[model samples]
Target: MALTDDVTSCLIDNNKLFKDIIYTAQYTATSANHLGYNDSSKHNSSSNSSNSSNSKPLPPCFDLKDAYRTQAFATTTVPHDIENPSVKRIQRRLVDKFLLTMRSFISSLLSLPILALLVSVAIYKTTVLHLQSSGDQRHHSMDEKKEALDELLSQDETYYIRRWGYACDTHQVLTPDGYILKMHRIYKKGPPEPSQGAKDTKKKPPVLLGHGLFQCSGAFVLNEEKSLAFMLVDAGYDVWVGNNRSIAGFGHISLSHKDHEYWNWGLKELGVYDFCSMVDHVKVHSQVDKVAYIGHSQGNAQAFVALSLCPEIADSLSCFIALAPAVYAGELVKNFPLSLLIGLNDWFYTLLFGNGCFLPIMSVAQQIIGPKIFCFMAYSMFSYLFNWWDHHWLRRRKAKYFQFTPRPVSVRLISDWISGWGRQGVLLYVQSPPPPPPPQQQQDGYRATSMTTTTVSSMPLPLSAVGSKRKLPLVVFYGTADYLVDGQKFVEKVQTCNPFPMLDLVHVERLEGYEHMDTIWGHDNHITTYPIILDQLSKVSYP
Candidate 1:
């Protein structure tokens, strides 16, 4: 009873009326136990005490049980059978408490597994997305490598042979030093009926085509669409493409036994000896006092060299067209890769290439990978950096031409052009000034000094001093976005030479989006830049 009172008081304080009623029921059960109400203890001492306490003598315990039974019977017999309000309230409270306990237990049981499943799904999705992005980047890199290789191999070859279609014969020009140079004569037909015999019967002057370093005369003629030779031929000029020594057509020339070392000569020797020989040969063969000269890249370098050393060549040049001229090699230093490449060990390259030519290895690589790989490689290395869409425009405007090669040239020749020029050669010319001799001692002694000096300063005269009274008219064109040549510096170098006043200060202009090779090979060159040169050429008159 005391425990009941305590429980009841705690529940009442908390305002839990249903809990108080349950505690009261528990107290009643405890009281019954204390009274010895087991079935076996029918006439127990507790029962006797209850009987003695009664006022009337108890007949028997059975009689008392009978009396109680009679009372329960009477109560059952009553008409209205109403349930107790406390009992109903207690039952409703029990049901609610059971439900609350069941809900809490069920929620606790489900929470752990549900949380684990959500975490797993999130991790899986993140992993899958990362893998997909990596795969895409790899695929893109591979595709680019494939495309670059193809373009290199797809260049035109037939164009070179086409320019030689009118060749009377191919002859080897032997040098005094025993080096042999190859020469091809392209015959010309008489001009278009001389405009119905209008008195003047002078024959048209022959136009000579000169290719650049690491390239042969074929380079000029190979691209039919953008071939310089083709353009001149179309313009009614007798086109003759000159292959420099050590290139595809001219590589086999036999050097004089006295100067077997001459084959080691780079552009320095090419300018002094090779170009001069070609010009003299062309003049004799064409029977013309002067010829129109068009030189591209390295060819332009040779032209300047020949004119500087042999100023009389200026008289032989009626007009000159320099395409992507490469007179001052210093201008190319602005290109990062080009500078690195030029600065590399020339001898190491010679050892790897053996003969110093690259085309053979490039050709082999192209054949192994196929055209698609070549194109992809080209696009990846060159496109994004140089904005090749503009280059595509330049190439599209020109005729498509193929390149042909008999075999690879020696890498030594290329090394000479890249390393021997500009840095090494220019420094030598600047540092070691040639000794000044009496005017009488200049002529014969000058030739002797030029022949004997192994250093750069003692080498042949600068190409800028082509004619006695006039410097060769220098015109330079480059792309502003070009990754190869510095267009601005190139223009400035020409201005330093102080060209003719009638000649513009500098002819340097940049193609919007052209690269190193794209100046000539690009599709838009024909439309955007070629016309400018053609217009200038049209105004030039031969004496």
Candidate 2:
């Protein structure tokens, strides 16, 4: 009874203490039996009496352990009946709770994807509606555009013909080789001024303007008002827009040679022959010992080659202003895709587009996706996003006017540019192959040739021909952010030329915030940058 009382007290205080009380009671009972205590029946009888009394609903002081032990033993004894029911109820509750948790977890995982799909659908609908609205607005804008175009055309007629008295005269100049090179002379009547100086002295200083690749004089002399030609003419410069050979304005040939393939030549031939011939003709027609040269892109390349190869023209040039000049193609092509394409196929390009035969494949490609007005607009928009202000101006300026007669240039010329001829001159100056060891004997040394012909192979002319000793006044202006030309490498190569002792004049001017095309086509070209160039020209002494 005492053991039962102690166990009941331990269970009420803490359930874990009941186990210790049970163990201690069992050990004491075993020790009393082993010591031969004869009162075993009395202890057993007392314990049974206490259990029975607790089971019969006795007072609070009655043993609760005996009742609890009796219930636990009954629960274990009825395994087949009550035990199965209780276990099944607990298992069902557990399964229901697990399923609820799983469903909540699955829904949480799918929320993001479902939300994203809904948002995507909403955006698509909004875009479609916006596009439909824009189309309607465009239709309305078209009528407005037409009215504006008519007004602009009327203004163009008045400004170009009636007010300014500008005229475009097409002429032919015969080269020594008997090729009749076409020329376009856009001149305006002299501005009203006093006759204080010589009669010819009052004539405006002629500014010969050249255009870029895949363009003509019309590119620069765009419209009556915004055209560079018109601006220069208004500013009292005799504006002569030169269309390089094979361009729209310069495509005309002599009747005898109209069908000849020789008339269609690349810049390699253009630089050597066409430009040289044009310079000669301009000098003779103008009757001026020297003239100012302003060239854009390919025009600059042609000028460099002509001046360098034919030093005689150097005396005839008052000053050279190259806009986005492509003189050093090796350095100019650092970021351009054309450089990689050319490097891949330099050895095989001649077979691809040689002997006046254009590549049919490239021709087809160009025809399919040629540089159209819309394409130019899109490119200009992207340029604008990148802060290429000049390109943006070029796009907006050109879009305001329509080209009357656009001409097709030979694919062979483009091929030559991609292949090597355009790159060869610059590469020779930049990439020097190891020199042949000084001849084993004096007699074995190679001798320099004195030929002055310009129809050499794509390889650069010998260093002797370049005249390593002559230090010509070389001024290179490049844009730091230009994608076409590597301004740093160009400066380095020019320094390596070592045009020393005779005033190795290497003036490198970096135009900030300019891209490859902005040098010529930028909006503020005439106002912002041209005066700086003119100042440089004033310093040059013409022969």
Candidate 3:
């Protein structure tokens, strides 16, 4: 009788605990085929004891991770109450409705662009053939021309690097937050002769290049020898290119792309985990005390935010070179449709588009359209969005440029940018409180030692830990005509506002006719911008 009583009490306790967990748990939707609970007929068919009178109803779909469940209680076979089945039925219906609506919306949205691209491709081919027949014929055969075009459309970054007589190595960096990022290291094909009075090949300083929003490391090498990556390699500096986690695909130690939790991050996580891990990896691999960092557009924002949160990593940087810095987007916030979309609050946004990757159909379409057609479509979209014209880019390399960009980004990352736009700052998603007493800092064009001696891994510094006194050399290149971000304003604010203290604004240049992407992809950038960047890098690294 005592054993029976104890068993009853135990079952009651477990049942109550299980109920609490289930009620509080957050549920994510999977397909009806993937989730057994969503398909009652299948579940009923699979059950052996369906006819048994003593058998209890099965629990509603529980999507909680293992961390949420207590081991002892997890094994407890508790059944659902009468109310849960109906609730779950409603949930399943709502999920189905939501997914169907999203799919329909996406399909409708994509149809126009897909149709436009098809037409554009047809016209592009017609024009090429017309040009060939209209006395524009070259000595090369049609097959050769097609072969060259195919190579341009299909080659990856490593292909270009090796083609340009350089060696490229791929390294996988594991972030503290379980993300695995792929990085590229570029060097000359053979052992580089020791520079005059240098120790050996190892003495060559390392420069890390980070790409802009929706771009991968491939952007740095797309322009062949004229690209910044190749230029740096030719200038006798080791070049390493950094990529975000979702560049090629969703890379994580434990989470698959299908998992909702995998997409639950924003620019904050990028700065904290991505930058920290990549910087450390570069520092350790190069066998150097510090690395010179260069970033363009959103790439610049990541570094700035990373420095703000984790001052300790500043020790690993020799200097920072920002190309079209995206710190202050005050003017950009006023742009059409984008302004309207960004104005929506988080809950409403998630309600409208579920919490997943942002505009996944774009990726799907990109894959389906093939590289050549996708490149034409990408150019059209960029031209419309940014008011950029074909004249802004190097004409010959334009197709190659589009082949690499517009990689997958999370909806949360875009939300984080919107949040920052509201604040009119680059400090994404984090409210900036009044900082402590300003540390003794150096002014423009001066170089100082690193701020902190403490080496950190993965963890960001606390807010109280701001105000490092060290001077980190910074060089800025901004386009006067660039409407995407107010780079001039970013320079002004960092110099005057004194946001953390280590930022030493050394040199500032305003390119008169340049636009946002002109810093890297413009025809004259190799002659006009690359030399100046090389000079700054050399000053900090060799000094």
Candidate 4:
């Protein structure tokens, strides 16, 4: 923002300077014309005609002096004309000056980004040197210091995971729609030995962890041992971390990231294709009929759409754990600037961010600035935008938290999310038909009416419509203080509407003072958040 202000100020000052220069040139020409310099050219022309051999061209100052004398002595004066050679020369000089100024302005404007990059590089180098010096002085081994530096500087999730003494394996799964997403599996660092825990590892149920918007799978593993991924691993669950399309790196089977078609997807596609494909892959890999699923914010939103619309994939989840689920506009978003921005048309949004990935340059900036500076900028931006204080964040590992996130997502995806804020009720991928009326309502010609209702005809009927069918367990952990999305309001709406009977056994826990990000990064979350998740995961009956 400071950089933007500096550039704006520069432009404004240059505009004022250009206006002043134009005014001075105009004033000088007008003064010359008032002194009768326009007639001097004709006066000189006639003289030159009469004494062609004797006459030489008058100096430029001579014309002004001759004009002043004629203006005082003669009875009439000639009007200013653009065709005057003297005036033309002056105009050409003015044009040349203006062009020179513009060239300088353009060069400076172009160099601002380059200057910012150079500064970022300088800071990065200085930080690297400082870390190396600190590492040498510290009691830790060289490998440990290297690991710490790698976690601070690397963009890969596996580096973060392995840095904390956890094993990480990267798996690429192909979605039906041609998007190849990356997933990370976290486990004990060493190979499985003939121990009791190692023997039981194969028997453990697999758990899939999905990150929030603009975040990759690395978000859950940033806090080292305190991170949700490591906690899950410690809790004897096989943890699989999932990424949405275009995150980390754009991996499409046929389309390039530069192509608009590669990014021509929104939340619906994420849920329908990315989430479903990952679940299927996890099931096949784990050799289980069902896998426990956990999602954060927009991750939960995708799960709601996927589990509600696709019965087969819905059945594949042993339990759906939603942390600070973002399915509706919160109080903060429903007001002021956010509401106004969200109300704009899709074309307007596309114009703002272009048709491709959203803010890909931020990733480049992050790499240049290094994690500490990037983390500070990110925190400041989010704090201002979301009115968050981040009091609960694990401050020691805050830089690492930002090292892996703010990944590239489609502009269409962000636009869709923004559009949803303008409406009331659950955010839907496609407009679903109104749910079937209750049996009593059907018999008496009365129907259920609620703003949050959603029903898919292609999927199996709800449990209310078809009594006592197998239902997907949806466990919700919401923060009372989260203003980005009203998780409490959504939970209440679901309970009141009872629209999704497929999610009949919905469990909701409201954390008293937690914020949106606190669900994942809160201090002592392993004790507060993970235990609840672990308790819920324990209830799932694995096949």
Candidate 5:
């Protein structure tokens, strides 16, 4: 971005005159079906000027050493309707109507579940009112009926902490870039009793758990007593689960929900700023020089970014474990429905709400009413997109899901991934002007010349971590039947990424019966995955 553009954006941000759409996304394809290549023009012209004189050569597959030697973001523009204003307008309007129709339709489909849950509560309430069998039920009968069910579904961080008996503490960690994220910590196992001596009086080595895309720390504990976060506390690791910046309940210290700047961030910031800062905070608080890192789903994406972009912190990591990791977007067209949805992500987003926050209302609704049709719709979409779910496990834990799953995330981030180019071989500007003056500055004239793009010539890896002399321990775990990840292909891509990747040791664990989320939330993760994870962490510590 030009210094002048920075000044102008800062001015706009201060006066709040800017629109929230991702302007840089003009290169975004009309349809998501374009092979996941970012347009070649996305890189800063100046950064790639020398190569501009000669036709650019094709990039190799994602070799960390070869990922982004020059500042370039490669992208391939698909057949979008942006060039025709009239058609674009029609497209967006048509899409908006369709989305509304779909939402209403989904509500109709999911209403059965909602109605069933509501009716059950009503019956329980009526029965208690008449029989007065238990004191707790009698007290409940007196409270307003409508408010009771809403309140039941809307439990917060504190409620879960108390319910499972985990010792809890809260921390507000400020990022270098000035975003203040609220973080939750578990120092001891729950069912807190006077005789509970499980927690070591001395601080244990820190272990940070990052939630999945759109989700908060709640996912780690949705299974209640059997949750991963609670289990970690039992194992004597000081557990910290964080809510990344773009999540529903999260916000930057300076940016308001209303500020366009709040929408400026994508997945990059979630990893580069949010996850990294929280790691620093935990180290200082626990006085532990190294910590174990576990990322579930997209959380793994952020950790990969941390290991790649911030090489200086390599030694700070004792180990990196990814559960249901989604590091590659290779051969996505194979998963036609998911690819199509992602391919048209931008168009649908444009049609639905034109580049601001994605589903902000849904975020609020989930919090206020707890789980409802909207949450059901979101989860159902996932079930269709990735069908390896163990039906039996879900049926057993059915009640916990509605109240716990479906986190709100920015559509911009989701759109980026669907683009394919965004995650696989994305290149970005090497230099950006100093961050615009905070909310206080009024500024003017900046022309951004960076033309970012993405190309998946190789598997994704950080330049530094790819070649690190001090290897970070890495364990990649996945569910065998998960379409979200091409399990076999991922292994092949990793082996081809480098002759020897920087990790001191790498282990790939693929399990049957488990799907994407089961690695972390399965009732038996303690029996299946946790032992491997703990064993890996122990190896790192002992080594």
Candidate 6:
């Protein structure tokens, strides 16, 4: 891209400038030394003549008095000693001045590249942004595909969510801490079915989908009809997508957007309050005692955090499905430049996104790559993170990527992982008693006495109770290539840190060719991934 080329040119310019500076410095140092030598020799001749009693007179042809027709030129003057420490100090001062001048010049020149990098990034972003806003595409030979894309250029989240046959509802969920989250639910539309026999009509359990980093709930419906949201509805489950504080919509009921409190939340707050509150709301609305949970990447990590805090979540929840669950990464996608890129990327993110939300699609980034070329930009930009070198796979999946990702995500949640500043791994699962469940409803239409409101796990840090032998049923769908989903490392950590046995890891043995994002939105997800998820859910006994 123009941005990349400009950066390359700036780097070359910096190198050339450095070489020139070195040459100039060498020349300046040499010239100063020659001048110092001539001055010192003159001082030495004058000083020796004044100090010696037997003075050596000059030859008649070279006499200064004969040439000037005057008396002795140096009478009564204190002749300077070139060998004195004072004279040497003066010479060193001259050389130091020359060196300082050269260093300052080189420093000023080197600084230009920093400005150039910023300018290039700005100009490239500006030019692309202008084209996207122009919307004057008559020069494209009147292609229908171009027109279709032009129409889709202005669609928002609600528009995309309703594209499939599923109905979308945005519910305002108020957390305990006053954060009002807009949770989107997708359910099949028709007259209400039987609440009758299991053999005659087996009603599906309520399922909630959690979006990964920098993405909204639209990730589920992005694959058109084949997305996980639609597939779950077709398979007879009530589907709801929970949007964390990272998205653009959620905020506090009392705290205004202008208030600093609106932006003062993190991933820990999300796990502690947002998810549990949403789960409570869903159970109340759907009349289901237990729910099924599915999450991708950061979604999976936060959910595990919630589970670790409350181990009874396994009983309150039927089963958990983690799609390329982002436990941790030893490195970002096993390679050299890829490793370097991850470190630099984290640095850039911290430099760019200091606080608040990161809106890549809606902000200046949209101008640089534009709405139409979103998929191309995403595929090319993130191709380094995946094992996506095969020409065929890249060609097949390039067009669909934009629909699923590059949405607004919380800076606090995403920066820790994306910026690569720290190892943003999941919390440890500890051996402790399961947190008590919510109070049961009495048969006389009265609520039973509730236990203590707060539930906190007291397990010691760094795997202190591995001998306690407690476990929760989990199903993981991961790929061989995703660095985030290290199969061996994940199993070992769970076994060593928690009471769970590593050998019992429920892996998707059937589906092979899947990567991190492919678990939820792959084109053939209904055929390959749905069966695995459904098989795990089917094992749960529905009331």
Model 2 clashes, total count: 0
Ranking by TM-score: 3, 4, 5, 6, 2, 1
Q: Give the Å shift of residue 381 in candidate 3.
A: 1.4
Report every candidate's CA lDDT. 0.43, 0.44, 0.62, 0.62, 0.52, 0.50
Model 2 clashing residue pairs (backbone): none
Model 6 C-alpha lDDT per residue in residues 1-543, reported as the tens digit of each score: 123343344554455543343233233324433434221121222121211211111112112113211211111011111011211112247786676456444533543464345445544554565467556443223321222242243325556556555577666554444455667777766665665666637557899888887666766765555678877888788888887763645454344433222454445445545666666657755778777888887777667656654444454566677777666564453554344434443334334443344433343354466654765555544544444322213233345446545665545444334322233333322233233233341233223221111121121112224475333346666655555456445544543343332212334332455566767655456666787777777776654
Instruction: Give a tens-digit lDDT track for model 3, residues 9-34.
Output: 66666776654434333222222113
Error of 2 at 474 (Å): 4.9
> What's every prediction's RMSD, in angstroms?
48.9, 43.5, 15.8, 26.3, 17.4, 29.1
TM-score for each candidate, following the candidate numbering: 0.51, 0.53, 0.68, 0.66, 0.61, 0.58
Per-model clash counts, in order, read 54, 0, 1, 0, 31, 3
Per-residue lDDT over 97-120 for candidate 4, one digit per residue giving the tens place of the 0 to 100 score: 676456445544554464455446
Cα shift from native, residue 177, model 2 (Å): 4.3
lDDT (tens digit, per residue) of candidate 5 on 1-543: 223333444553443211111121211211211333332333333222222222112221232122221111111011111122221112247787787557544544544464345445544544444356334322223222322132244437657766667667666554433344667888655343353465545445789998876667877776666678887787767899887865534444334545333454455556655776677767766767787889987887777655555555566678888787666543443554555454443333344433445655555665666355544444454455455343324333434564555565655555545443333332231112233333333222212212111211222232343353767777777776565655555454444343224453357676765677778766567667777777776666622
- After superposing candidate 2, which stretches have Cα over 4 Å from the reference? 1-165, 177-179, 189-191, 194-201, 223-226, 249-260, 330-340, 343-391, 400-407, 421-475, 496-508
Clashing pairs in 3: 445-506
lDDT of 2 by residue, 1-543 (tens): 123343344444554443343333333334433545331121122122221221111111012123222222221111111111111112247787676456444543543354345445544554454466553423223323432243232212223433346665554543222233456666665556555667535665566777766556666654335456676666556556665655532222222212223334444445545565566556655667666777776777777655544445565566666666574553434433344444544224333333232322322333344345333433333232222333224333444322322234554455445433334534111123233344353234324322211122121112333446443344455666675545545454443343112223224556766677666655556654566665555555545
Candidate 5 vs candidate 6: the lDDT winner is 5
What is the lDDT, from 0 to 100, of the residue 330 in candidate 6?
Answer: 42
| Alpha-carbon lDDT of model 1 | 0.43
> In candidate 1, how many clashes are counted?
54
